[model samples]
Target: MTTKNLPIYQIDAFSDVLFAGNPAAVVPLSTWLPDDVLQKIAMENNLSETAFFVPVTAGNADFHIRWFTPTVEVPLCGHATLASAYVIFNQLGFEGDIVRLQSKSGILTARRYLGAIVLDFPKQPIVPETIADDVIAALGGDTPVETFGVASRDTDLVAVYDDATIVRSMTPDMSLLAKLADRGVIVTAPGDKTGLDMISRYFVPAIGINEDPVTGYMHCVVAPYWADKLGQDDVVGYQASARGGVVACKVVGDRVHLTGEAVLYLKGEITVSA
Candidate 1:
Protein backbone atom coordinates (compact mmCIF):
# COMPACT_ATOMS: atom_id res chain seq x y z
CA MET A 1 0.00 0.00 0.00
CA THR A 2 1.17 3.52 -0.78
CA THR A 3 0.74 5.97 2.05
CA LYS A 4 0.89 9.70 1.40
CA ASN A 5 -0.40 12.95 2.76
CA LEU A 6 -2.19 14.66 -0.07
CA PRO A 7 -3.02 18.34 -0.01
CA ILE A 8 -6.72 19.18 -0.28
CA TYR A 9 -8.81 22.31 -0.38
CA GLN A 10 -12.44 23.22 0.10
CA ILE A 11 -13.73 26.08 -2.00
CA ASP A 12 -17.03 27.92 -2.27
CA ALA A 13 -17.91 28.18 -5.90
CA PHE A 14 -20.25 30.48 -7.90
CA SER A 15 -20.38 33.01 -5.10
CA ASP A 16 -18.24 35.97 -4.20
CA VAL A 17 -18.98 35.60 -0.52
CA LEU A 18 -18.21 32.73 1.77
CA PHE A 19 -20.96 30.29 2.88
CA ALA A 20 -23.20 31.32 -0.01
CA GLY A 21 -22.03 29.04 -2.79
CA ASN A 22 -21.54 25.34 -3.32
CA PRO A 23 -18.55 23.96 -1.44
CA ALA A 24 -16.34 21.52 -3.32
CA ALA A 25 -13.22 19.67 -2.28
CA VAL A 26 -10.17 19.88 -4.54
CA VAL A 27 -7.29 17.37 -4.56
CA PRO A 28 -4.26 18.08 -6.75
CA LEU A 29 -2.00 15.16 -7.42
CA SER A 30 1.14 14.50 -9.40
CA THR A 31 -0.21 11.09 -10.36
CA TRP A 32 -3.55 9.38 -10.48
CA LEU A 33 -4.57 7.08 -7.67
CA PRO A 34 -6.63 3.95 -7.98
CA ASP A 35 -10.25 4.61 -8.87
CA ASP A 36 -11.56 2.99 -5.70
CA VAL A 37 -9.28 5.09 -3.53
CA LEU A 38 -10.44 8.24 -5.30
CA GLN A 39 -14.04 7.29 -4.71
CA LYS A 40 -13.30 6.63 -1.05
CA ILE A 41 -11.79 10.07 -0.68
CA ALA A 42 -14.86 11.69 -2.20
CA MET A 43 -17.13 9.63 0.03
CA GLU A 44 -15.08 10.59 3.06
CA ASN A 45 -15.25 14.28 2.21
CA ASN A 46 -19.06 13.99 2.17
CA LEU A 47 -19.50 17.06 0.01
CA SER A 48 -21.63 17.38 -3.09
CA GLU A 49 -18.56 16.73 -5.22
CA THR A 50 -14.84 16.21 -4.82
CA ALA A 51 -12.51 17.01 -7.70
CA PHE A 52 -9.26 15.22 -8.46
CA PHE A 53 -6.72 16.55 -10.95
CA VAL A 54 -3.17 15.86 -11.95
CA PRO A 55 -0.68 17.93 -13.90
CA VAL A 56 0.02 16.50 -17.30
CA THR A 57 3.17 16.77 -19.42
CA ALA A 58 2.30 15.56 -22.90
CA GLY A 59 -1.13 17.07 -23.49
CA ASN A 60 -2.25 20.54 -24.54
CA ALA A 61 -4.23 20.68 -21.33
CA ASP A 62 -2.20 21.62 -18.29
CA PHE A 63 -4.15 19.22 -16.09
CA HIS A 64 -6.53 16.31 -16.25
CA ILE A 65 -9.58 16.45 -14.01
CA ARG A 66 -12.12 14.02 -12.62
CA TRP A 67 -15.18 14.43 -10.44
CA PHE A 68 -16.66 12.01 -7.91
CA THR A 69 -19.88 12.09 -6.02
CA PRO A 70 -20.37 9.91 -2.95
CA THR A 71 -21.45 6.87 -4.92
CA VAL A 72 -19.94 7.19 -8.38
CA GLU A 73 -17.70 9.19 -10.65
CA VAL A 74 -19.67 11.83 -12.45
CA PRO A 75 -18.98 12.79 -16.09
CA LEU A 76 -19.11 16.53 -15.39
CA CYS A 77 -19.27 18.73 -12.33
CA GLY A 78 -19.21 22.53 -12.58
CA HIS A 79 -18.62 23.84 -9.05
CA ALA A 80 -15.77 21.42 -8.44
CA THR A 81 -14.17 22.35 -11.75
CA LEU A 82 -14.34 25.99 -10.72
CA ALA A 83 -12.81 25.11 -7.37
CA SER A 84 -10.01 23.23 -9.10
CA ALA A 85 -9.27 26.22 -11.33
CA TYR A 86 -9.15 28.48 -8.30
CA VAL A 87 -6.63 26.19 -6.68
CA ILE A 88 -4.43 26.09 -9.77
CA PHE A 89 -4.56 29.85 -10.24
CA ASN A 90 -4.27 30.99 -6.64
CA GLN A 91 -2.63 28.18 -4.71
CA LEU A 92 -0.41 26.56 -7.32
CA GLY A 93 0.52 29.93 -8.81
CA PHE A 94 -0.54 29.12 -12.34
CA GLU A 95 0.72 32.00 -14.49
CA GLY A 96 -1.65 31.67 -17.40
CA ASP A 97 -5.01 33.36 -17.73
CA ILE A 98 -6.63 30.04 -18.61
CA VAL A 99 -6.41 26.51 -17.22
CA ARG A 100 -7.75 23.78 -19.43
CA LEU A 101 -9.10 20.74 -17.64
CA GLN A 102 -8.94 17.52 -19.62
CA SER A 103 -12.00 15.80 -18.24
CA LYS A 104 -14.30 12.92 -19.07
CA SER A 105 -16.63 15.43 -20.69
CA GLY A 106 -13.77 16.72 -22.84
CA ILE A 107 -11.65 19.83 -22.60
CA LEU A 108 -13.29 22.19 -20.15
CA THR A 109 -11.47 25.52 -19.88
CA ALA A 110 -11.52 28.19 -17.24
CA ARG A 111 -10.24 31.71 -17.70
CA ARG A 112 -10.32 35.05 -15.95
CA TYR A 113 -13.05 37.42 -17.05
CA LEU A 114 -13.31 40.79 -15.30
CA GLY A 115 -11.70 39.15 -12.26
CA ALA A 116 -14.21 36.31 -12.15
CA ILE A 117 -13.48 32.84 -13.47
CA VAL A 118 -15.49 31.88 -16.52
CA LEU A 119 -15.79 28.21 -17.38
CA ASP A 120 -16.22 27.26 -21.02
CA PHE A 121 -18.40 24.14 -21.07
CA PRO A 122 -20.28 22.51 -23.88
CA LYS A 123 -24.00 23.18 -23.91
CA GLN A 124 -26.23 20.19 -23.37
CA PRO A 125 -28.76 19.65 -26.12
CA ILE A 126 -32.27 19.98 -24.71
CA VAL A 127 -35.39 18.28 -26.03
CA PRO A 128 -38.93 19.02 -24.99
CA GLU A 129 -40.53 16.16 -23.03
CA THR A 130 -43.69 15.49 -21.17
CA ILE A 131 -43.40 15.15 -17.40
CA ALA A 132 -44.74 11.90 -16.04
CA ASP A 133 -47.46 12.00 -13.43
CA ASP A 134 -45.20 10.49 -10.82
CA VAL A 135 -42.49 13.00 -11.63
CA ILE A 136 -44.95 15.82 -11.24
CA ALA A 137 -46.13 14.32 -7.98
CA ALA A 138 -42.55 14.14 -6.79
CA LEU A 139 -42.25 17.88 -7.27
CA GLY A 140 -44.99 18.74 -4.84
CA GLY A 141 -47.74 18.35 -7.45
CA ASP A 142 -46.91 21.62 -9.16
CA THR A 143 -46.98 20.96 -12.86
CA PRO A 144 -44.25 22.91 -14.58
CA VAL A 145 -45.06 25.09 -17.54
CA GLU A 146 -42.64 23.04 -19.59
CA THR A 147 -40.34 20.08 -19.20
CA PHE A 148 -37.26 19.20 -21.17
CA GLY A 149 -34.65 16.48 -21.22
CA VAL A 150 -31.05 17.58 -21.41
CA ALA A 151 -28.44 15.13 -22.59
CA SER A 152 -24.75 15.49 -21.82
CA ARG A 153 -22.42 13.45 -19.67
CA ASP A 154 -25.56 12.80 -17.63
CA THR A 155 -29.19 12.87 -18.59
CA ASP A 156 -31.14 15.47 -16.61
CA LEU A 157 -34.66 16.81 -16.58
CA VAL A 158 -35.39 20.52 -16.51
CA ALA A 159 -38.75 21.69 -15.23
CA VAL A 160 -39.59 25.26 -16.07
CA TYR A 161 -42.08 27.13 -13.93
CA ASP A 162 -43.71 30.47 -14.60
CA ASP A 163 -41.55 32.48 -12.19
CA ALA A 164 -38.67 32.26 -9.79
CA THR A 165 -40.92 32.57 -6.80
CA ILE A 166 -42.24 29.10 -7.47
CA VAL A 167 -38.76 27.75 -7.70
CA ARG A 168 -37.78 29.27 -4.39
CA SER A 169 -40.84 27.98 -2.64
CA MET A 170 -40.39 24.36 -3.64
CA THR A 171 -39.98 21.50 -1.15
CA PRO A 172 -40.01 18.40 -3.23
CA ASP A 173 -40.21 14.85 -1.97
CA MET A 174 -36.70 13.64 -2.55
CA SER A 175 -37.72 10.04 -1.99
CA LEU A 176 -40.28 10.24 -4.75
CA LEU A 177 -37.83 12.10 -7.03
CA ALA A 178 -35.30 9.31 -6.64
CA LYS A 179 -37.73 6.93 -8.34
CA LEU A 180 -38.29 9.19 -11.34
CA ALA A 181 -34.81 9.70 -12.72
CA ASP A 182 -31.38 8.25 -12.40
CA ARG A 183 -29.80 11.71 -12.73
CA GLY A 184 -30.41 15.33 -11.87
CA VAL A 185 -33.67 17.23 -11.84
CA ILE A 186 -33.32 20.97 -12.38
CA VAL A 187 -36.35 23.09 -11.51
CA THR A 188 -36.06 26.58 -12.90
CA ALA A 189 -37.94 29.71 -13.89
CA PRO A 190 -37.34 33.28 -14.96
CA GLY A 191 -35.76 35.24 -12.19
CA ASP A 192 -38.13 37.34 -10.13
CA LYS A 193 -35.45 38.97 -8.07
CA THR A 194 -33.67 42.09 -9.28
CA GLY A 195 -30.61 41.74 -11.51
CA LEU A 196 -31.43 38.08 -12.20
CA ASP A 197 -32.61 36.54 -15.43
CA MET A 198 -33.39 33.10 -14.01
CA ILE A 199 -33.35 31.02 -10.84
CA SER A 200 -33.06 27.28 -10.31
CA ARG A 201 -32.87 24.51 -7.74
CA TYR A 202 -31.15 21.20 -8.41
CA PHE A 203 -32.09 17.84 -6.95
CA VAL A 204 -30.13 14.70 -7.69
CA PRO A 205 -31.12 12.05 -5.19
CA ALA A 206 -30.33 9.33 -7.71
CA ILE A 207 -26.67 10.25 -7.43
CA GLY A 208 -26.82 10.74 -3.64
CA ILE A 209 -27.22 14.49 -3.82
CA ASN A 210 -30.59 15.79 -2.69
CA GLU A 211 -30.05 19.48 -3.28
CA ASP A 212 -27.16 21.37 -4.77
CA PRO A 213 -26.83 24.95 -3.62
CA VAL A 214 -25.30 26.30 -6.82
CA THR A 215 -24.94 24.34 -10.01
CA GLY A 216 -22.85 25.90 -12.78
CA TYR A 217 -23.10 22.92 -15.13
CA MET A 218 -26.87 23.22 -15.06
CA HIS A 219 -26.75 26.66 -16.67
CA CYS A 220 -24.94 25.10 -19.59
CA VAL A 221 -28.28 23.43 -20.31
CA VAL A 222 -30.72 26.10 -19.17
CA ALA A 223 -28.81 29.21 -20.31
CA PRO A 224 -29.51 28.63 -23.96
CA TYR A 225 -33.14 27.97 -23.17
CA TRP A 226 -33.39 31.22 -21.25
CA ALA A 227 -31.41 33.13 -23.85
CA ASP A 228 -33.93 32.14 -26.47
CA LYS A 229 -36.83 32.80 -24.15
CA LEU A 230 -35.57 36.20 -23.01
CA GLY A 231 -34.22 37.09 -26.46
CA GLN A 232 -30.70 37.72 -25.17
CA ASP A 233 -27.57 35.68 -25.19
CA ASP A 234 -26.25 37.03 -21.92
CA VAL A 235 -28.09 36.36 -18.69
CA VAL A 236 -27.71 35.99 -14.95
CA GLY A 237 -29.09 33.23 -12.71
CA TYR A 238 -29.33 32.45 -9.06
CA GLN A 239 -29.59 29.07 -7.40
CA ALA A 240 -32.11 29.50 -4.64
CA SER A 241 -30.88 26.90 -2.22
CA ALA A 242 -30.49 27.55 1.47
CA ARG A 243 -26.99 28.63 0.60
CA GLY A 244 -27.66 30.68 -2.52
CA GLY A 245 -25.35 31.68 -5.41
CA VAL A 246 -25.15 33.58 -8.68
CA VAL A 247 -24.00 32.33 -12.07
CA ALA A 248 -23.36 34.42 -15.15
CA CYS A 249 -24.30 32.73 -18.40
CA LYS A 250 -23.62 33.48 -22.04
CA VAL A 251 -24.82 31.25 -24.83
CA VAL A 252 -22.49 31.05 -27.81
CA GLY A 253 -23.36 28.43 -30.40
CA ASP A 254 -22.85 24.89 -29.04
CA ARG A 255 -20.91 26.09 -26.01
CA VAL A 256 -22.03 27.99 -22.95
CA HIS A 257 -19.98 30.46 -20.96
CA LEU A 258 -20.51 29.89 -17.23
CA THR A 259 -18.89 32.61 -15.13
CA GLY A 260 -18.72 32.75 -11.36
CA GLU A 261 -16.52 33.50 -8.39
CA ALA A 262 -14.92 31.08 -5.93
CA VAL A 263 -13.52 31.76 -2.49
CA LEU A 264 -11.15 29.71 -0.42
CA TYR A 265 -12.81 27.93 2.48
CA LEU A 266 -10.33 25.52 4.10
CA LYS A 267 -6.98 24.01 3.17
CA GLY A 268 -5.57 20.84 4.64
CA GLU A 269 -4.01 17.48 3.94
CA ILE A 270 -5.46 13.97 3.98
CA THR A 271 -3.25 11.10 5.01
CA VAL A 272 -4.19 7.87 3.31
CA SER A 273 -2.71 4.56 2.24
CA ALA A 274 -3.76 3.09 -1.08
Candidate 2:
Protein backbone atom coordinates (compact mmCIF):
# COMPACT_ATOMS: atom_id res chain seq x y z
CA MET A 1 0.00 0.00 0.00
CA THR A 2 1.16 3.52 -0.84
CA THR A 3 1.33 5.80 2.16
CA LYS A 4 1.23 9.60 2.19
CA ASN A 5 1.83 12.24 4.80
CA LEU A 6 -0.74 15.00 5.27
CA PRO A 7 -0.33 18.21 7.20
CA ILE A 8 -2.80 18.86 9.99
CA TYR A 9 -3.43 21.86 12.21
CA GLN A 10 -5.30 21.86 15.47
CA ILE A 11 -6.88 25.22 16.15
CA ASP A 12 -8.88 26.70 18.97
CA ALA A 13 -11.76 28.48 17.30
CA PHE A 14 -13.81 31.37 18.73
CA SER A 15 -11.04 32.10 21.24
CA ASP A 16 -7.73 33.86 21.04
CA VAL A 17 -6.42 31.78 23.90
CA LEU A 18 -5.55 28.14 23.54
CA PHE A 19 -7.68 25.40 25.18
CA ALA A 20 -10.48 27.87 25.74
CA GLY A 21 -12.70 27.25 22.74
CA ASN A 22 -13.87 24.48 20.39
CA PRO A 23 -10.85 22.78 18.94
CA ALA A 24 -10.97 21.49 15.36
CA ALA A 25 -8.41 19.62 13.32
CA VAL A 26 -7.83 20.93 9.78
CA VAL A 27 -6.20 19.00 6.96
CA PRO A 28 -5.41 20.81 3.75
CA LEU A 29 -5.50 18.52 0.77
CA SER A 30 -4.44 19.17 -2.80
CA THR A 31 -7.18 16.85 -4.00
CA TRP A 32 -10.15 14.99 -2.65
CA LEU A 33 -9.78 11.85 -0.61
CA PRO A 34 -12.17 8.90 -0.19
CA ASP A 35 -15.12 9.35 2.15
CA ASP A 36 -14.08 6.47 4.39
CA VAL A 37 -10.59 7.86 4.65
CA LEU A 38 -11.88 11.27 5.69
CA GLN A 39 -14.12 9.68 8.29
CA LYS A 40 -11.27 7.58 9.58
CA ILE A 41 -9.05 10.61 9.87
CA ALA A 42 -11.69 12.50 11.74
CA MET A 43 -12.16 9.55 14.08
CA GLU A 44 -8.42 9.31 14.69
CA ASN A 45 -8.26 13.00 15.59
CA ASN A 46 -11.16 12.49 18.03
CA LEU A 47 -12.08 16.15 18.10
CA SER A 48 -15.53 17.61 17.75
CA GLU A 49 -14.88 18.12 14.04
CA THR A 50 -12.18 17.74 11.43
CA ALA A 51 -12.03 19.82 8.26
CA PHE A 52 -10.64 18.96 4.84
CA PHE A 53 -10.34 21.29 1.89
CA VAL A 54 -8.91 21.22 -1.59
CA PRO A 55 -8.19 24.22 -3.79
CA VAL A 56 -10.86 24.80 -6.41
CA THR A 57 -10.04 25.79 -9.97
CA ALA A 58 -13.25 26.19 -11.98
CA GLY A 59 -15.67 27.81 -9.62
CA ASN A 60 -16.49 31.05 -7.87
CA ALA A 61 -14.92 29.67 -4.69
CA ASP A 62 -11.29 29.45 -3.66
CA PHE A 63 -11.63 25.96 -2.25
CA HIS A 64 -14.04 23.12 -1.57
CA ILE A 65 -14.47 22.28 2.09
CA ARG A 66 -15.98 19.36 3.96
CA TRP A 67 -16.46 18.52 7.63
CA PHE A 68 -16.59 15.26 9.53
CA THR A 69 -17.23 14.30 13.11
CA PRO A 70 -15.99 11.01 14.49
CA THR A 71 -19.09 9.19 13.30
CA VAL A 72 -20.48 11.02 10.30
CA GLU A 73 -20.01 13.81 7.79
CA VAL A 74 -22.03 16.91 8.53
CA PRO A 75 -23.51 19.41 6.13
CA LEU A 76 -22.36 22.62 7.78
CA CYS A 77 -19.72 23.28 10.41
CA GLY A 78 -18.75 26.74 11.61
CA HIS A 79 -15.64 26.40 13.77
CA ALA A 80 -13.84 24.03 11.45
CA THR A 81 -14.46 26.34 8.53
CA LEU A 82 -12.99 29.19 10.53
CA ALA A 83 -10.00 27.02 11.38
CA SER A 84 -9.54 26.07 7.74
CA ALA A 85 -9.62 29.72 6.69
CA TYR A 86 -7.07 30.56 9.37
CA VAL A 87 -4.73 27.90 8.06
CA ILE A 88 -5.16 29.19 4.52
CA PHE A 89 -4.60 32.84 5.34
CA ASN A 90 -1.85 32.44 7.92
CA GLN A 91 -0.20 29.16 6.98
CA LEU A 92 -0.56 28.75 3.23
CA GLY A 93 0.20 32.45 2.64
CA PHE A 94 -3.05 33.08 0.84
CA GLU A 95 -2.90 36.79 -0.02
CA GLY A 96 -6.51 37.76 0.35
CA ASP A 97 -8.83 39.22 2.90
CA ILE A 98 -11.71 36.98 1.83
CA VAL A 99 -11.69 33.24 1.32
CA ARG A 100 -14.66 31.71 -0.45
CA LEU A 101 -15.39 28.04 0.20
CA GLN A 102 -17.95 25.86 -1.50
CA SER A 103 -19.43 23.10 0.59
CA LYS A 104 -22.56 21.01 1.02
CA SER A 105 -24.35 24.06 2.37
CA GLY A 106 -23.32 26.21 -0.60
CA ILE A 107 -20.92 29.11 -0.83
CA LEU A 108 -19.48 30.33 2.44
CA THR A 109 -17.09 33.21 2.88
CA ALA A 110 -14.57 34.00 5.58
CA ARG A 111 -13.27 37.53 5.77
CA ARG A 112 -10.68 39.24 7.88
CA TYR A 113 -12.62 41.65 10.00
CA LEU A 114 -11.51 43.88 12.85
CA GLY A 115 -8.81 41.43 14.03
CA ALA A 116 -11.23 38.49 13.80
CA ILE A 117 -12.54 36.15 11.13
CA VAL A 118 -16.09 36.83 10.02
CA LEU A 119 -17.93 33.87 8.57
CA ASP A 120 -20.85 34.57 6.24
CA PHE A 121 -23.23 31.62 6.35
CA PRO A 122 -26.78 30.93 5.33
CA LYS A 123 -29.31 31.59 8.05
CA GLN A 124 -31.01 28.44 9.22
CA PRO A 125 -34.52 29.69 9.81
CA ILE A 126 -36.62 27.68 12.19
CA VAL A 127 -40.35 27.36 12.73
CA PRO A 128 -42.37 26.32 15.72
CA GLU A 129 -42.55 22.58 16.28
CA THR A 130 -43.76 20.18 18.90
CA ILE A 131 -40.83 18.70 20.74
CA ALA A 132 -41.01 15.16 22.05
CA ASP A 133 -41.80 14.76 25.73
CA ASP A 134 -38.83 12.50 26.25
CA VAL A 135 -36.59 15.12 24.71
CA ILE A 136 -37.83 17.66 27.25
CA ALA A 137 -37.55 15.14 30.06
CA ALA A 138 -33.94 14.40 29.15
CA LEU A 139 -33.16 18.06 29.72
CA GLY A 140 -33.89 17.82 33.42
CA GLY A 141 -37.70 18.37 33.09
CA ASP A 142 -37.57 22.11 32.58
CA THR A 143 -39.82 22.82 29.64
CA PRO A 144 -38.66 25.26 27.03
CA VAL A 145 -40.33 28.60 26.48
CA GLU A 146 -40.57 27.67 22.82
CA THR A 147 -39.52 24.83 20.55
CA PHE A 148 -38.49 25.12 16.93
CA GLY A 149 -37.20 22.97 14.12
CA VAL A 150 -34.94 23.96 11.27
CA ALA A 151 -36.82 23.98 7.98
CA SER A 152 -33.82 22.93 5.98
CA ARG A 153 -32.80 19.89 7.96
CA ASP A 154 -34.62 17.27 9.99
CA THR A 155 -31.74 16.78 12.42
CA ASP A 156 -31.83 20.16 14.17
CA LEU A 157 -34.15 21.41 16.89
CA VAL A 158 -34.10 24.62 18.92
CA ALA A 159 -35.33 25.03 22.45
CA VAL A 160 -35.79 28.52 23.78
CA TYR A 161 -35.59 29.21 27.49
CA ASP A 162 -36.38 32.25 29.61
CA ASP A 163 -33.03 32.54 31.37
CA ALA A 164 -29.41 31.77 30.70
CA THR A 165 -29.11 29.93 33.99
CA ILE A 166 -31.38 27.14 32.78
CA VAL A 167 -29.27 26.67 29.73
CA ARG A 168 -26.05 26.59 31.71
CA SER A 169 -27.26 24.12 34.29
CA MET A 170 -28.59 21.50 31.91
CA THR A 171 -27.28 17.95 32.39
CA PRO A 172 -28.94 16.00 29.63
CA ASP A 173 -29.47 12.26 29.24
CA MET A 174 -27.38 11.51 26.18
CA SER A 175 -29.02 8.15 25.54
CA LEU A 176 -32.46 9.71 25.32
CA LEU A 177 -31.16 12.54 23.16
CA ALA A 178 -29.55 10.09 20.78
CA LYS A 179 -32.90 8.36 20.38
CA LEU A 180 -34.74 11.52 19.39
CA ALA A 181 -35.90 12.15 15.85
CA ASP A 182 -33.81 15.30 15.77
CA ARG A 183 -30.13 14.57 15.99
CA GLY A 184 -29.04 17.85 17.54
CA VAL A 185 -30.69 20.09 20.11
CA ILE A 186 -29.79 23.69 20.75
CA VAL A 187 -30.91 25.34 23.96
CA THR A 188 -30.71 29.12 24.03
CA ALA A 189 -31.78 32.05 26.16
CA PRO A 190 -31.32 35.77 26.63
CA GLY A 191 -27.86 36.53 27.79
CA ASP A 192 -27.33 37.27 31.49
CA LYS A 193 -23.85 38.71 31.27
CA THR A 194 -22.70 42.12 30.13
CA GLY A 195 -22.14 42.73 26.41
CA LEU A 196 -23.82 39.48 25.42
CA ASP A 197 -27.24 39.34 23.84
CA MET A 198 -27.69 35.56 23.84
CA ILE A 199 -26.41 32.35 25.37
CA SER A 200 -26.57 28.85 23.90
CA ARG A 201 -25.60 25.23 24.53
CA TYR A 202 -25.48 22.56 21.84
CA PHE A 203 -25.94 18.80 22.26
CA VAL A 204 -25.65 16.34 19.40
CA PRO A 205 -25.10 12.84 20.67
CA ALA A 206 -26.20 11.47 17.30
CA ILE A 207 -23.25 13.25 15.76
CA GLY A 208 -20.83 11.93 18.40
CA ILE A 209 -20.54 15.18 20.39
CA ASN A 210 -22.44 15.32 23.62
CA GLU A 211 -21.89 19.05 23.97
CA ASP A 212 -20.01 21.22 21.56
CA PRO A 213 -17.84 23.82 23.30
CA VAL A 214 -18.29 26.85 21.02
CA THR A 215 -20.41 25.94 18.05
CA GLY A 216 -20.41 28.14 14.97
CA TYR A 217 -23.16 26.59 12.85
CA MET A 218 -25.54 26.39 15.78
CA HIS A 219 -25.13 30.16 15.98
CA CYS A 220 -26.64 30.39 12.53
CA VAL A 221 -29.92 29.36 14.12
CA VAL A 222 -29.54 31.21 17.44
CA ALA A 223 -28.30 34.48 15.96
CA PRO A 224 -31.39 35.09 13.90
CA TYR A 225 -33.62 33.88 16.70
CA TRP A 226 -32.11 36.30 19.21
CA ALA A 227 -31.96 39.17 16.71
CA ASP A 228 -35.68 38.90 16.12
CA LYS A 229 -36.46 38.53 19.81
CA LEU A 230 -34.24 41.40 20.88
CA GLY A 231 -35.12 43.62 17.86
CA GLN A 232 -31.43 44.03 17.18
CA ASP A 233 -29.75 42.83 14.04
CA ASP A 234 -26.33 42.60 15.60
CA VAL A 235 -25.62 40.77 18.82
CA VAL A 236 -23.01 38.80 20.67
CA GLY A 237 -23.49 35.21 21.87
CA TYR A 238 -21.71 33.21 24.53
CA GLN A 239 -21.67 29.42 24.45
CA ALA A 240 -21.87 28.24 28.04
CA SER A 241 -19.78 25.11 27.80
CA ALA A 242 -16.97 23.86 29.98
CA ARG A 243 -14.47 25.60 27.70
CA GLY A 244 -16.59 28.57 26.74
CA GLY A 245 -16.05 31.07 23.90
CA VAL A 246 -17.76 34.10 22.46
CA VAL A 247 -19.20 34.70 19.01
CA ALA A 248 -20.30 38.04 17.61
CA CYS A 249 -23.23 37.71 15.25
CA LYS A 250 -24.99 39.94 12.72
CA VAL A 251 -28.19 38.92 11.01
CA VAL A 252 -28.90 40.28 7.59
CA GLY A 253 -31.83 39.55 5.31
CA ASP A 254 -31.16 35.86 4.75
CA ARG A 255 -27.65 35.39 6.05
CA VAL A 256 -25.92 35.27 9.39
CA HIS A 257 -22.41 36.59 9.83
CA LEU A 258 -20.37 35.11 12.66
CA THR A 259 -17.15 36.66 13.88
CA GLY A 260 -14.58 34.97 16.06
CA GLU A 261 -10.87 34.41 16.51
CA ALA A 262 -8.86 31.22 16.13
CA VAL A 263 -5.40 30.41 17.41
CA LEU A 264 -3.25 27.58 16.14
CA TYR A 265 -2.62 25.02 18.87
CA LEU A 266 -0.57 22.47 16.94
CA LYS A 267 0.83 22.01 13.46
CA GLY A 268 1.90 18.53 12.45
CA GLU A 269 1.51 15.73 9.95
CA ILE A 270 -0.46 12.47 9.69
CA THR A 271 0.52 9.47 7.66
CA VAL A 272 -2.31 7.80 5.73
CA SER A 273 -2.24 4.70 3.59
CA ALA A 274 -3.13 5.37 0.04
TM-score of each: 0.97, 0.98
lDDT values, one for every candidate: 0.90, 0.93
What CA RMSD would you report for each candidate? Answer: 1.1, 0.9
Instruction: Please tell me which predicted candidate would have the highest TM-score against the true structure.
Output: 2
Q: Write the per-residue lDDT of candidate 1 for residues 1-274, one digit (tens) a residue.
A: 9899999999999989888899999999999999999999999999999999999898779999999999899888899999999999999999999998898889999998786899999888888877688987888888799998886534688899997778899998898888887788899999897899998999999888999888878888888999999999999988899999889899998998999999999999999898
Candidate 2 lDDT trough over 10 residues, lowest sum = 175-184
Clashing residue pair totals per candidate (backbone < 3 A):
0, 0
Looking at model 1, residue 261 earns an lDDT score of 92
| TM-score (C-alpha, index-matched) for candidate 1 | 0.97
lDDT of 1: 0.90
